[model samples]
Target: MRLAVVASHVIQYQDPFYRRLAAHPDIELTVLFCSAEGAKTYHDVGMGTTLRWDLELLQGYDHRFLRNFGWGEGFFRLVNPGLVPTLVRGNFDAVLFMTGWAWLSAWIGFAACRVARIPIFLYGDSSYVPDEKSVRAKLRAAVMRALFGMTSAFMISGKLNGDYYKHYRADPRRFFPLPWAIDNERFVEGSAFAPGERDAMRERYGIAHDELAVIYSGKLIERKDPMTLLRALARMTHPAIAVFLGDGALRADLERYASHGLPASEPPSFPVSQEAGRPGGSAKSRAAFVGFVNQTDLPKHYAMGDAFVLPSHFDPRATVVNEAMACGLPIVITDRCGPSADIVRHGENGYVFAPGDDAALATHLDALARDAEMRARMAQRSREIIATWSYAEGVDGVAAALKSIAGGEQT
Candidate 1:
């Protein structure tokens, strides 16, 4: 089978999945990128940093960079006219579009594939539950419904992602199960840190062995609501550490909250200070504001955490959750995250709370922190869950999609 993957750029997470797909003996894969955004050092608006991914994204995969007509990742900005000609020349059995109609290039590729009568498999992280319900939202939903109908098949990223297409009235048989995932082998193997190395990382953060480290890894942007974790940690009665592994515009405020509790004038979000039985205080727990950690170094950082938390206002699919699970850390994430609906079994592998529900978040955090046995059990369960959601599953979905489509030319 010859497969062509259309994407915006070289994402650090997706690169490994692409490599896994390319390595399949029965398949030949070629990735057509609209730009080289992540290939070179660039400014990331969310993370508030300028850096290139440390990993080699192009190796172990066949790929090409198309001529980009615009500058950034905007719907219209990612226009790539060269895709039409490239598709014609590549003679690919099918096109795997990694995006919806968010980019002009997606529409262009759709048109080209439709004319050539080649099946197009659509894959994305969009969930059924949207953040807003407005006039514009309705219009976008209508557009997506049409987009979903036109695609030959859907590569379901998660339960919520599958729900999205179903809500759009997409055919049920067209769904291919490919859970949102990470390179589990790398994280599982790489995160096996030497006891001394783990201790050194904790020492660097001033996190005593007695303190439970609640790790938060991602951009510290408002959408991710990094402060919720801070506020939750502040409410903890026992000694715990909030370890932020990424940086963003919210860094300074997070640092400030680490030093001082939620501002008094700001009207407390969590009833930590005035709680009935619990010892009241102003951000009693400490925090380690470790700046942006790269791809290769993430496993070690993940290994140091007692538990992982993602307090996002909304995330289509939080890949960091997958990475943390692969590293054998239990999860505590917001319900708004797509992975929360699928990977995170409430009170099983980890817990799930509503976005901004600091009380619930704090309560869950406290439960994990207070019990060493529970944390270890949940951590083991996390590894078990992640084992099923790996790059191999992603490839299986692609191969299934390829085989289902007409003229797929499977070996």
Candidate 2:
């Protein structure tokens, strides 16, 4: 089967999946990027820095970069009028869109495919959440419902993401499991280390042998709620330290909070006030803010930590959670994360707390930090769970979806 994929740009996390799909013997795959954004150094507003992925994203895949004609960023920046002719020339049996209909390029591609009578599969990780009772929300819901109607099949990212389609009244039979996964083997290999190697990595990050190092890897932005992890760590009486592996707008505030312990009496807020904390220094360093780690070096960071934490206020599916699991670290994330529903089994692989509940987060951390046996058991379970959520499984699901569509079974 000849399949064409339309995506916003080449991403470090997504490159491996594309390569795996392209390597399939029965399928001919081509990825069409709307922009050459991550292929070179660019300013990332979320990380608040100019950076490029260290790994080459274009290798081992049949791909093309469409010429973009729009301005600004995100949905607005990706206006590629050249996609229509490119899709026409490819003459793919089916077109798979890696995103929704929020951008001009997607609508244009959808129109071209519709006119050509080609099956269109929508694949993304947008979960169903209650929207505000506003005019904008209503309009967006209507637009998404209309878009769902045009889709021939839905490549479901996870349970929550599948609910998004169900919420739009999509036929259940049209849903196919295209798990949001990483190159698990690469992560597992990169994370494997000898006793001395692990110790050296910990020493580089100033993570003491006795302290329970919690790894939080992502943009230190408001949505990620790094403050919750900071607050939870501060209140913990256990000997623990936080190893942050990304940068963002909240870096300065987090640094100050980490260096100076907060007053226990301060009222809890969405973003715990940076002003309320006094200059009382911590017993030792509470956290380390290692900024913006690249794709190749992530496993080493994951190796040095005992537990992985993602305290996002809202995240559809944080693939970093998957990466951490692949590295054999127990997870501690908020329910707002999409993977919490399926990948993370509470009390089995890790624990899940309500978003903004630092008290609950602190309790879970303390439990994992204090109990070596529990951590070991949970760590093993994490590896077992993530081992099933792999690129191979995703490719199989895609091929089955194609066959079903071709046989007039999935409509």
Pick by lDDT: which candidate is best?
2
TM-score (C-alpha) between model 1 and the true structure:
0.91
lDDT of 2 by residue, 294-313 (tens): 88889989978999999999
lDDT of 1 by residue, 120-184 (tens): 88888888556448999899778878777777789999888888789888987888977777778
**Candidate maximizing TM-score:** 2
Q: Rate the local accuracy (lDDT) of all candidates.
A: 0.82, 0.85
Score candidate 2 by TM-score against the native: 0.92
Off by over 4 Å in 1: 131-136, 262-285, 408-411
Assess every candidate by TM-score.
0.91, 0.92
True lDDT of residue 392, candidate 2? 80
